[model samples]
Target: MRLRSLEGRLTLLLALAALTGALVYIGVTEWPLPQAFAWMQEAMGRHASVFQPSRVDIFVICALVLLPLCWWLGHIVMDPVKRLLRALESAVASYRDGDFSISIALNRRDELGDLIHMHNELGQTLREQRQNLAQRELLLDTVVQNTPVALVLTDAGDRVAYANIAARHLFNEGRTLNGLHFATLIADAPEALRKAIEGTEDALFSVEMDGSEETFHLSQRAFRLQGRPHRLQLFRRMTRELSRQEVAAWKRVIRVVSHELNNSLAPISSLAHSGAELARRGDVQRLPGVFATIGERARHLHGFIDGYARFAKLPAPRIAAIEWKPFLDALALHCRFQLQGNAPSQPGWFDPVQIEQVLINLIKNAHESGSAPEGVTLGLNVVGHELRIEVADRGPGMSEAVLAQALLPFYSTKRSGTGLGLALAREISEAHGGRIALANREDGGLRVTLVLPQSATAS
Candidate 1:
């Protein structure tokens, strides 16, 4: 082995010890034995009874010198090893305590040196990883704290575990919300807000706060955190978004109305001019046809105006218990549809007249959707606490782009479509505290669903 290595050093020490013993033996037995014995006899002459010298005295003397010499040599060889072991032990303890900054700086030209180098690299890697993790956590905290949405995280015990800055400001007036019971935190909240938070479903509710009404959309999720159940609630302010949408809706309405009026009136004006020119030329027979054409356009324009007026002036629904069989029978008179199944035996709560109108408009749309007349179908059923009225057609379904804006007023696919049919249905459904959903069927069709609460009243 190389002399600088640990194994080499131990071998060198053993060789040196053996050599020293050999030299001591040669000097005592061969070079100075007779002289040493004469000196020892003179010094022991005064204590002759206690000092009985023998031929083996040289061996005892050699042992006395060699034992201390061997001990000193062993200490010289093991001191570095002992110190390195101490350093390694300390560094491992520090690592166990989550302190990766501790590193052994001892250098050796052996296996211990390689161990130290590997240990330092591990520490460096751990330190870098910890730093990156801490930075990511800080960035995430910054975003959560500054977001406009209020966020609350509660533990399995229903106690608040985390609340962001917005959540604190919203619920506790800038006070910390950690460790508070979730129910107690919302105890003083508005009835609508309390009900929305306590319920298992997501909801949108308005609260009168600081003399103005603020609307919020509440969403909740349940998940496992560290193998324990937790719930997260997010409240997003939607008042400004809703206000912007309302303004844009009014602008679209005005634009659509102007375009429609010009389309109808321009042709009517040109026809009138033609009729007057013919009169000047003494064309009396053509005058009646011109007037008849003008009447038809006028009637179409009147009907166009009346549809918008009715949509804008829709009354609140007058809810009443009505049987599905009679209502469906009455709706069949206005629009032909194949009822998919037997009507519910249970009576539904809704305004029969308004619902009948909604079904008629839907069935009419299905009939005009390029489907065979027999392919248009209507379905009614009660699901949970809601009543679902579905109108489906086996026609080519709409594209993603069209489906997104289909429920908006003045959005239509047809050349003569007023676009108020689906929009009016949506408005009526919402007025009864319900909603409408549009989906595409798997077999190539569109499904329009009007969902109303079975026990809902006008809202």
Candidate 2:
């Protein structure tokens, strides 16, 4: 056993004293040397009467001889125990001061050494855990502070527990938000928080703050932290996304309404002009020709209206698995008249009817943009998992102003154009989970690329 402090020292001293007493009694009462010496003395003094030693003298001599032997035995027993006690005391002192470097010195293979080894191992583990926790906390703080989106954490009762800097600025306007109720911080927060807390369903919802036109998309999720329920409210600004969607919807509406109005107005305007010209000329014989011109313009205007109507009322695609090679072949056959003598260097791959319409619109736009000798180049390629179909023209690309409003309905750069072809193509591509992008080609031309996902080949 190990010992420490004054109490341990006293106990060790008492134990040593008891051991000394027992050793002294065994030496005096059970020594075989006294019997053997007495027998030798009797034999030597057999013919003469010898003097006998007193009991007191014998006791003193025995005491003097055994004293040193007892001291040596005590030293032998106490020395190792004292060293072990001192080592234990030092170890305990270091542990109390939070220093784990101190270790017990073991001179022999024993249980005490095994215990010290295990204690050191546990200390190492605790130190490592502390470091890891510190790092994780630092990382979490960085994310919470630097993220653009507002983050709020709530307890099981729907009380606000933590709010990040962004969230605080958003709800409290640089004021303190800690300990504030979740309902009080948000303008329409009560209903939103109630929906998250009372409802068991997990969902994403948008909430617009009252008095302010700010919209926030809120996603509620319930989870357990340390066996306690925690609800996280992740807020994202939806003003831009919603605005873009609204603009697109408005464009669609305008395209449909404009087409309908133009259909009626164009025919009426042409007929009225023709009738006035016939009366001014005073030529009854030319009246039929004027009427014919009116009819032709009216038919042309009807065709334009029909095109716009088709774009506005485009039906949802009935998606089907199709062989890309055969589809492209059919598209080429359908557009053979437009292609004339031009053939692509590489084979094209796409859906036939849908892609043909896209190609026709693009080619028609290209034809209107410029004349021959600087003709349009239609290119198709499969890059990675996307099929890129590009219609590039050698004519001057669109100006910045026109480029900006190119896809908007009723926005046209050409004098005699309806400006619905590119918009229709964009709508179709978006419906198919694809995109169409316009850019100026490097060689002073316009490049329109239609990017579509490639269907997987069946095994």
Score candidate 1 by TM-score against the native. 0.60
Best candidate according to TM-score: 1
lDDT of 2: 0.69
- Report the lDDT tens digits of candidate 1 across residue range 1-459: 776788887888889899989888877776676566667877779455444335597688789879999999989987877988898889889989988898888877787788889989999999999999999999999999999999999998999999999999999999999999989888888999999998998999999989999999999999999999999999999999999989998888887788788888998999999999999999989999988988988998899999999999999999999977777778878989998897776789998889889989999999888889989998888888888899999989899999999999988888888889999999999998899989999988999999999873311
Q: Which residue pairs collide, candidate 2?
A: none
Off by over 4 Å in 2: 1-270, 273-284, 323-351, 371-375, 457-459
Per-residue lDDT of candidate 2, residues 1-459 (tens digit): 446443455577667766766665555555654565567678888765554446675577567866776687667556766777788788778878877667665644344456656766766776788689889999999998778788888877767788888888877886766677776555455466457544655434555566556556666688997899988877777788888978987886676557656765777687778778878988678778767876776787678778878887988755555554565566556443222333333343444556678887887777667734346666666676666778877678888888887887666776566778888888878777679999987768788899876555511
Each prediction's Cα RMSD?
9.3, 13.8
Q: Please give the CA lDDT of all the candidate structures.
A: 0.89, 0.69
The model with the greatest lDDT is 1
Q: Count of backbone clashes for each model?
A: 0, 0
